[model samples]
Target chain A: MTPPRTPVLGRRSLLAAGAALPLLARPAIAQNSLKGTKLTILAGSWYVPENNTQLDQLAAEVSKDTGMEVRVERFAGDELGTKVASVIGTGRGADLGVGVEFDTYLYAPKLLDVTDLAEEIGKQYGGWFDVARAACMVDGRWKSLCIGQAPAAWNYRTDMFAAAGVDKFPDTFDELLVAAKKLHAKGTPIGMTLGHASGDARSTNYPVLWAFGGKEFEADGKTVAINSPETIAATEWYAECFKYMDPGVTAWLDPDNNQAFLAGKCSATINVNTIYLAARAAAPTDPVKKNIVENMNHGLWPKGPAGRYANYNINVWLPFAASPNPEGQKAFLRAWYSKNFLPNWTKTGQSYFIPTFAGFDAMDVWPDDPKLKIFRELNKLNRLAGYAGPPSPAAAEAVSKYVLVDMFAKACTGQMKPAEAVKWAERQYDQIAKKRRA
Target chain B: MSATTLPAAPARPRARRLASWLDNERTLGLLLVAPVVILLAALVAYPFFTAIRSALSDQTLADAGEFVGLDNFANLFQDDIYLRALRNTLVYTAASVVAKLVLGLALALLLNETFPFRRLVRAAVLLPWIVPTVLGTMAWLWMFNPNFSVLNWVLTNIFGLRGLPWLTDPALAMVSVITVNVWRGTPFLGITVLAALQSIPPDLYDASAIDGANKLQRFRYVTLPLVMPVLLTALVLSTIWTFSDFGVVYGLTQGGPMNATHVLATLAFRTGLTAGQIGEGAAISLTMLPLLLVLIVWQLRRIRRSAVA
Candidate 1:
């Protein structure tokens, strides 16, 4: 049976691979062999300043250790995706691209299989998450290495919740609704994007659907299962819940909520730690910044009808098949995954990059910070967009089209009724499934 | 004067060869235009034909798949979003074009008259045209922010008007996008119309006045008729530019509030670049080609007729 899209590579594959290739077997070629080779790695622009400095240091250290000159290039997330897509079939791009999602699946045929390297890393890091394995492994071969999974959670203002007579964050959907109404009455409102944002809409909305037991596809990952009573109920809930949100949330993009929360206009919002990190970047003595940091706190997504899940947009790094220096690229990947840099890198991420391996939990990155520790539990329950099924091309297509998020937005915005929105989404899911199967 | 012939003429070889070459007008003309012709074919024609080919195939960003033979176009007809995008493009272009023409003509008429600092005023009027489109669109994005919009502050505080959802509601989102397009595009029309206005002979206006015509009558008979040709050319070019506008709507709304503001260009970019459906994206964009061609042909014919008349 196919593995559920878990971040861990899975116990069965780990056990099978261990019997075949011993744990200590090093698949990496001689590092000194690529002394004169130069390769490039493409990544998204860093939201945190330390991330930028750390990457440069990492590249410099890699060059010093292996004598292979590694260069790093940065572009905005969407821009990087476009660049990768534009050069996919041309066999020319960065040797390795970081954080690419749907494009990784679309261009899987043009990526080098890193199954051996992945398994080796898994052995050292206490095994990969099943979702991470499902994301990178295509047709039973690993196409990319799961680098980081940014598990999204609810980041809210403590002061606002306290002022509304709520002492603790909500634990279920009903409680969240009640807290939101009280917070709205207190003048500050919650914000979960209900728009065509490039990232937030899909990342934040899918968990709400999952909370109500609405899966995009069945366990087989083949049948369309979105048109259900659960989805309709979720839609109706959004329609009412929207009344307590900022009126302008339907226009919010990825950065909009971050800006709103920082400006103190929002009581709560669903997002990763990027917003928290951005607030902390301000001068510590600054009253506004201090107030923001003191008032802000996070919670795991409220439990849904089925169970709890957070949207983990699992990011991966893949080596291009047409890379001129495969040995140099593989060496870079190994060095990047080393404990020497990985721990520091994870800390610099500031809870943004929750390590997929179990051993990473031992690192001080999450435990040291009071607020950051909560993220560990949140990331533990992270799931990919197609929660009940394996990550497939059809699932990726559904995400790219913003199918699930759009359904909720339509229902909440009065563009369509709950049932009608569900019907519309069903048709879209059918198309994606049919085209992918064909 | 007719048939007097000299008995003999001595011609140097180099001079005779030069004369022969200079006499070949057609060859020289072809040679002069060869560079431009080659450049156009390589840059414009090739990409256009490639778009057509891609539209007819199942090609994606990752792989160049087999030809699907009109399936992409057939699918677009059944796609609600594609139809909505097509409808948005037409509405956006038409609304923006008419507004630009009217406002541009008014500005041109005002600028044409001799006034204080006329030269400085003329230069300043081109500011919107001179500014980069992306930068201008970004500024507009901020101004249209739902919470802290300066426009909202002014409307509510100063003018006592209700707060407007500039980029949220479907009708208002379209209005916002079209308003920004007109703001940036009107300067192009103004400058072009101003040039045309200056070229009209002062004698024509005087002649109309002498024939017992008032200022309005003179403008209607002389200025309007004489400026018709240039105005039509500018209108056609502006229509093409506005129809393919990608950045303004993308920056301001991102075709959001449920894709209400998406035009063919944004839809195509989303489908091909973002969604990885290169073939379908190509089909959506190429649909604009035939419509634009027909518009250009019709407008050019009007310009030619006005010029001849």
Candidate 2:
């Protein structure tokens, strides 16, 4: 047993308090002293080399002000969910961790509700939440587990659009389809994805499914709504759109698919905006970006039967209750969210990702850029855009196994009908729903 | 008379002392092994307990329901989808093993030939196996895709046909996944078979040649018998690996074109991990334990019988 007359505290905190007694003493002890302090951030390739360099300088500054050190862990974004889930399931994860979109939804009972933290932070930052946290709520609790800029939706090659005689962005799915087919006929695949991978398939396909008025959940969100007629039409329509998608989509992960579009191989690709950096990186001298900045345009998602809805894959930094230093973690998060962290972090990625921070809207990260306006406007109205999360990555594997994936194969091969495929998914999901649920 | 005379000094004490000494030796041996035994027991307990508990309960991961005994398993039996997953697992195991063995042996024989850049060729063959399974499968997925697959491109444009969805068709998805396993697993099979092949004496082949034994006869007589034991071991390992494989199928097609590719292990993992139907997941995985035990027991008995013979 630890006998306690008084709690022993860190030298930093004790000194902070010791100085608090005298108003001048607090500022006298600088916060940026890197000694006796460490900050660990759980993130994906978010903090690139430049970001790290900036962060190092910031850490130096912070150490002088409050005596803290900072570091980052880079994981592949796609793998973050399962990795974090494993850690959280095992009852251990980082103090301040950024969770991917689907992972944010799959938080087990081991997680801490960041609702109060979100409210507290919201009070300080004033609407840092770019979207409603509705899709993130589980069983009546809010989750701040996700905070990404938004999903990439507008990808168009001005060079190709001009060559194809397209003047403005298509406002309807029908017009978009026509443009896509024209581009394809002109030998330009209009989009890209790795179709075999679920992440790619869902991101590229699910939006069209939703925008086309197909839903995986009923209106009340009480049951599976995937088998509806609209979903079938959506699937068929999507299958039609495949003609224009780049052939390499089957193997593409992330920005690569979009990178293909920006490479001038496709007229347009609905992909993450951060990938434009990769395209620039791949070939900075390419005439594509320069001309497109002058010619290409961005707009709200093309309308479909369900109206225009774009999927937003968000990432967030959430505090874990199991953290040994929850108070320290919370304090770090508070300091981390301030506008000071936003611009440097965004700038350091070399303009790789949009900032989810409120008031990042006016930042010159990409002002006057064609797609920034669309991204900003969409970011303002971002929604999880689904009654269900991506088939609960666990259930997704099972369903993909038992029905959906194989049925897609069959339907794509013309061995089965779209209705047959959806029916297969329903039947397979029923049994899968029973045996292995995640 | 001699016994009585010798025992007169102390027969009972000696026997008692000897017995005690023997007992101590036995206890010491057990004491030495106890930690390892306990460690193994602990290692296996959680999954066992989880499986047992889950098998009995009604799995309500999505809705969060009260425990329902035997319902999940009952549903397992009743549900054709899960039944299909089991069926696919069995098919995958049988096909993957046979394909790996045959393809591996053929490749091994080719590499066994004295050729230029033999080391380079051998290294190249093992590349897929060395590459992470998920990453390799992702490449395969790209190659098999209808829209972008180089495989489909070569098949359709070069041969003048149409694109085939290699990973989509129900039957073909199994073929695609099995083909990937074969591609990755063949290296393992080749190395094992090559080792076994290298063990045979040059003298045996010389003798067979001197006897006018044809190539076919020589292989059938000499190679088959010599490699059988090692082959069996390899077969068992590949069977287990293929049976439990999750990464390849998960990354490639995610068991799709409609669940036709799901194996038993993947099924259990998906249930327990994804659905949090902890109980059902446990049960699904547990179903394999008994069957695997039987196989292992059968192998052990065969090895014993061979030794005895």
Best by DockQ: 1
User: Ten residues in a row with the worst lDDT in model 2 chain A?
Assistant: A1-10
Off by over 4 Å in 1: A1-32, A64-67, A283-285, B1-29, B299-309
Error of 1 at B176 (Å): 1.0
Compared with the true structure, model 2 gives a TM-score of: 0.78
Docking class of 1: medium
DockQ of each: 0.50, 0.20
lDDT of 2 at B151: 86
